[model samples]
Target: MAGPLQRVLMRSAASAMHRAKASEWHYGPGFDPQKAAAQYEALTMLVLASGAEIEWLTDADDGLADSVFTHDPSLMTDHGAIILAMGKALRRAEPGLHEAAYRRMEVPILGRIEHPGQVEGGDCVWVDSRTLAVGRGVRT
Candidate 1:
């Protein structure tokens, strides 16, 4: 899915990412929370400068270190958002967070991939408005 950034859903790094357990999250020894936060701030500023509207997800220390990756939890479409089920076991709760954000933002829910049908937004490639190609693998 390639398009101009008009609106985006983002979670700040102030929560889980700030206190991410490097071993659990598979982050390398080079991982630094402060640097990550600074980079996030820079990116946020860029997104704002681009005139895009950002809908932020609430930050909380829920031990979901990977929660800051909002894109993988849901897929946005012209109609509504498709709540995705994560392939990664640690990210299972992430979809619920996105769902809650959508409800708060008044964004409609098109459908969701159930327990047995796991799908990650990153593995989905939209060829057009209606054409979608889904890849299946370890991370799908």
Candidate 2:
């Protein structure tokens, strides 16, 4: 028994896997682009699970350590979002930029994290619709 909706969803999943396999960038001995591309595909799985069809203001700039200075699109909830202050020095800019994107998304900012405390997207896990388990990374 296969409904059209279920069939479409299944197709989307299979296509995603195919694209991940087709990605040719590979990380090498010193540093590898292929490996990096593969990692990016893995991380995109998380983004795909958001459940909310939201838009993104991608920085696409890789100068920062995390390259996400303030792209906290995760804060876009039905109620509001709490702006996260990142712990990484290079990505401290991420929160402010996140604020701007949230503004464009028209989502309300319920609160924010102060300095001396930082959040990294790579260390965050959205376990459920309303729950998240975020970890800290080693500071340089």
**TM-scores of all models?**
0.93, 0.50
Give one digit per residue, the lDDT tens place, for model 1 in 1-140.
56778998888886668778787788899999888888888988999999999998878777777887777899999989999999899899999999999999999999999988888988888887789888888877
lDDT of 2 by residue, 50-124 (tens): 442434444344333233222332343347667776654545665665677668767789987676755555466
**Which stretch of 10 consecutive residues in model 2 shows the poorest summed lDDT?**
1-10
Cα RMSD of all models vs. native, in order, equals 1.3, 9.5
Query: At residue 4, what lDDT does model 1 achieve?
Result: 73
RMSD of 1: 1.3
